[model samples]
Target: MKKPSKCQSPGDSSISAKENDAQSNRSRDSKVAPKSEGLATGLDETEWKSRLTTPEIVLKEIRTLEGVSYYHGMVARDLVESKLTRCGDYLIRATDNRIMEFEFILSFFNKKRIHSHLTIKCDVEAGKWALGLLSVNQFSSVVDLTNFYKTNPIGAGFFLKRAISKGKYMIAHDRIKYSPKDDLLGTGNFSDVFRGKIELENQMVNVALKTTKLLDDTMDPTKNVKANKIKKEMIQEAEVMSQLRHANVTSFFGIAVDRLPILLIIEFCNGGNLQGHLIKFGDRIGTNERFLYLHDASAGLNYIHAMSITHRDIAARNCLISVNGFVKLSDFGMGLKVRRNESAEKVAEDDDGKENKEPKLPVRWMSPELVDTPDAFSKMSDMWSLGILAYEIFTNATKPFFNLDDTDVMQTVKSGKHPPLPLSMGPDLIRLLKDVLVAAPTQRTTADKFYNELHVLCTQKGALSLNGLTINQIRGISRKRVEHVTYRKLSYAIRMVTREIGVMHHRRCWLMLFGGERSEVSSRTGSF
Candidate 1:
């Protein structure tokens, strides 16, 4: 068994002696010419071969019969359908797309450019398959093509199995099963999010399942096209989600494609979103507690920025609060990866200007630059949203630029005016908001630096608690009273320890702490 050279043509002497000699000379010259000199000219035994950008297997057959004429190759196999086109004097194009035996004809028409004058022929027969060719240079083999459609955030779309095996975050869709009729968490243009459950590491946990609508079986052609577009967008969102894993970021379990409308299984937050939390708890929550949520949101934003991602839509509604009081950022429809030296306008805007129509953007939260060019979303633009988020938190979910339309908000921001800080906000919190809310995107503070500053302010405000007591609560206690409470606790611990252990063992514990032999300690205490 021997492999063939690239563009190798078989021998044929059916043409005139002069043409045969010309063909022979060209064959010899082709061997010596640079392989990069892909296409050359000659007749029936000539080996002027150009490397077709076809699949590896298809190229092999094409090279085996490059010298054969088109007429004879077609007659040799009796193929159901065939096509021929004279691209130039040097090249001939042939294509076949019939669901029949695996027989491929490889031949070309003679140089006289007459359909009746067929000079040579070669036949290739192999295993069975049929592929339609939209172009002469493209080929799709069984091994290279998969029936299933799949995509991820950072790589080319591939078969479902390959996607799962290749990506670190990808999981098999079969591993997830959801209730057909469940409480719908939310709905979007092309998807409906439902509360579902999935088995993770042998534990059944609640998850949010976002499923894309079925487009393949749509009755309307227009809707079918739109559905496909939405499916791609959702897959892109899933791709970004798979790459991310942070304490303050929502977790993506995997994609469920075992059925219609691909499903994205994600971690469920019991406390809902920051928007609802503020609206419900409003006046009952203190300023310090609100700062804690702000800190969490900032931490998430910083993590995403470190990974070079711009969460184009950042607002209170996009932030989720866990039942345990942890805040995680969610919703990644407008997320985009930053490229080196790319301008905001190029990276942020969709080329088609379709993102502006459906799936509305946060108008009041958007920065001046983003307002002008929606695609100009950057880390700085995210900072602007963070400012709005802070205001929403402090004001108990009050809408930014309340009662003002999109135009009003844009004009006000451009005029160097911003929402006033809530009366409850201290000087430090107000300063942090000012840094993020600057009209100029370039002047805005970085997410990490802003996060650090807010963290410090949070600590200063006694937003952090120690052993169930906030610093403020602890401050109100008198020193003598605190000492009395500490002494009582100490006595209680000693009594409990003595009851749990025998007297001899308890004496040994004291001796170990005091750096004395148990015998000596017992003698001094006159106990054991």
Candidate 2:
């Protein structure tokens, strides 16, 4: 298993020849690749083999198939259907979807303006290959099978079509070591983060193996299309991650497209995530110590925000704890690279003004704008979640809105209120939270300001006091308090009651004026 630092065509005869030999050894005498994995004593062979990209697989199969001009591996079916016109116009494309038993997928544009995909499979027992089921004819090899189908109509009255192989997408894939089932770190809807190892430069390095299953049902056009899209995004994610460099930001090792499920290798944190650390030891931590953790995270946040990348998912759970007990932000599944001249604040301007209404989000740490429609995550959303992260630290990771249902969390956000931080926190810290937790994106404190202030406070409490607060600065304590911290949520309740009372008083005044005036006028008329 050679890991190249750069991209190469896996279809190269030499590369395929070597890989084919290795693959054959793994399978007992079967000419085709084995579909399942069997346990081995030392390292898992499947993990290493999964590093083999699509072009390698196709080249291995067609190594001896004569007259098959070009091998275009792992092409999207949509591109094939649109480009190939006329009935019987056909092309062969490999799929990253691992489920299909294949020589290749035969995509033909039918007369009905639609495409039909027929799986080409091999029967190891007969040592023959066939196209389409219900066909009685079987050929000695895939080349012969494809030749037979080219001229003869199966059941659909279809005739021979040109075998077209378009431009191939080839790239050098990196390497990843197998992560055992027991070493799995976490899971997500589209990807899983495994505690795994990879060889970097010359030495072994532990990494967060973020992977999505590429070996699924490719027969379904929708599923295959989606799998490919995810692959593209994974590649794009790697591109974005490469630009980020900061001690507080989790380091990206590289991405591997060589295997069935592609790999995005990230720096693994040994102390687990900040959320877990807070839950276990937050109560025991002092204010200054907690500020140090927030300070570390803000430094990372400040760096990425400057890079023009929006880490849509930012929270205590996403923030990993390093061996030194510092906070490093992780998890970029929802991250999007901001386009040039585009501001993250403007991206969140909703015409409908809808907030994320999802009853429950992971850890319930999402910004208000993101909660309604996941698509509307603004660039400034990182700050919103940072505020939540601060709360998690202050509260020692106590679950937010514990008394409120998840549904109420959305409602709470809609009403321009958030689950408050502890009033017992230092006044300067409360004021800082006030600056960040605001609903308006423009009003929220900038990451630069947040990080700078926190950095100062971490060294000495109330060190961020301004010129106006010289007395407090001299005392080394912030006399300036966030007066509303204790009564902010109460003000919301008070506002509602006062509004009701004002409406009642106005209604009574209007009724009295109308009734009293009419009675006085009637009495005067009767006396006259």
Candidate 3:
């Protein structure tokens, strides 16, 4: 399989004639030099032959055929565009329904001119009909084209079928199912979580969904607030998640909004939250396990930050562990869209109104600015929270700010005081903690820089002794907590129901005594 040469000029017939001879080995190859028209006068026979053999030309011809579709044409276009001019290979499907393999050897005569010689072998037909060019650029480059086809075979197939059926390309049909089971995941005011099957598409598999919720409850209607807020948050989160198609981040399935409870169905993580895992397994989780969770969390956060959104709440609780050991950042409730022009004055004003009646902020993990003023939130603040989370994970669920009351913590934060790293903590971690937990927001490290530094610390040669935790261990801890909390609420409801029954009986007796005598007297007077 000799490579094809690049197209230089019409007069440059050496490579073209050579390519024709090579292509003729399998089937008879003919070179036709039609006179150049108008602006194409400078174009010679070789240039014209190159244009005819070009992938673009082949793709265009394929589109005109009855079976070839627009999407396949696009895929073909991408495959060709990405090819190097000199070293390219392609699989051509001829107009007469035969496959021919060819390679192009590219060379540049001048900056403006190039030449190519195509070596081809016809697998089926003997003579040339209308040649449909599918050029291969290099050996093993087929993998690149294969990957593209694998990702978009359905799309291409749909385009082909659509063009054939309708005589023109139309919108492809979306057959994604949206059902009640798909609507199980939801985000709350304080937490973002989801409950759904892990494998909704094919088999029955259990999975839990995770996300952050940031919508103000004061704005949503009371009766339908939670559902409405969850729905809206899910929609927005899905939109954002859809844009972020990364392996480290959670994978998004099709969403179901037509039902009463709108669901942003996602692949469930059977392993619970990191916070619960540490509390349950504590000393059992090795250093490497710890680093794994941290690494995955950092990767996910880095991706989020890259998309210009800060995961404001980066805690163990928000880091979800899957049964298969995959870690994903779940809650997006507290996440904020990074703004370019966030003024300090505007932040101050927003905080001023909420001074008297502010929601109880998580003091221990909160950044100094948040404790000092409610509106003092930024990307730096999120980094501070991440630092606190890392500290919690490292310590195996020790109290975030132990031995300090909320007021004292607030006061200390206001005065620019921060908790010191434990003596046992490694230098890399200690540095990370100090850098993120700096009192001044301006001085705090950015998420991007933090992630890069963390990656180095984790991957570096024995910087810190740590390993990653499995997703199941993390989930086991979190799930137990959720179950226990649920049981407590259910028990409370049962007790309340029993007490209410007795009270209702007493009230009924009292009503009968007060009204019974009056009713009897009225009946006797009617007779008189």
Top candidate, metric TM-score: 2
The candidate scoring highest on lDDT is 2
- Whole-model lDDT per candidate: 0.48, 0.53, 0.42
lDDT of 2 by residue, 1-528 (tens): 212111122211111111111111233322433443321111255543443333333333543432244334344455456657777777654443333222355677776766777666544445555554533666675567667777787557877577764432222222355544556786443345778665445555566766553323222533444445555566667766755545577766566443344556677777677777677764566665577667777877765665556786677768886543446788874334222121222122211224322112442566676655556666567788888888888897876666676567666765657677887568888888888888887789988778767666654674332234222222222333211122222323433444556744433332332221111112333210
State the lDDT of candidate 3 residue by residue for 1-528, as single tens digits: 333332222111111111111101122136643433211111234533443443432222223331322121111122222332322122221111011112222111122223222222221221122111333322222223323433332122410011111112111112122222234343332333445443223444443433322222222223232333334454455555544433345554434321111234444555656677788887877765666566667666655554556666667766766544555776553333322122322121121222322223455666777754555666787788777777777888676657676667667766766666665557777888788888888998877677667767766734333233333334242211111122222323433444556634433332332221111112233210
TM-score of 1: 0.53
What clash count does candidate 2 reach?
9
Q: Distance (Å) between predicted and true CA of 14, model 2?
A: 25
What ranges in model 2 sit over 4 Å off? 1-94, 97-174, 188-190, 213-219, 334-360, 462-528
Q: Is candidate 1 or candidate 3 better by lDDT?
A: 1
The predicted structure with the larger lDDT, 1 or 2, is 2
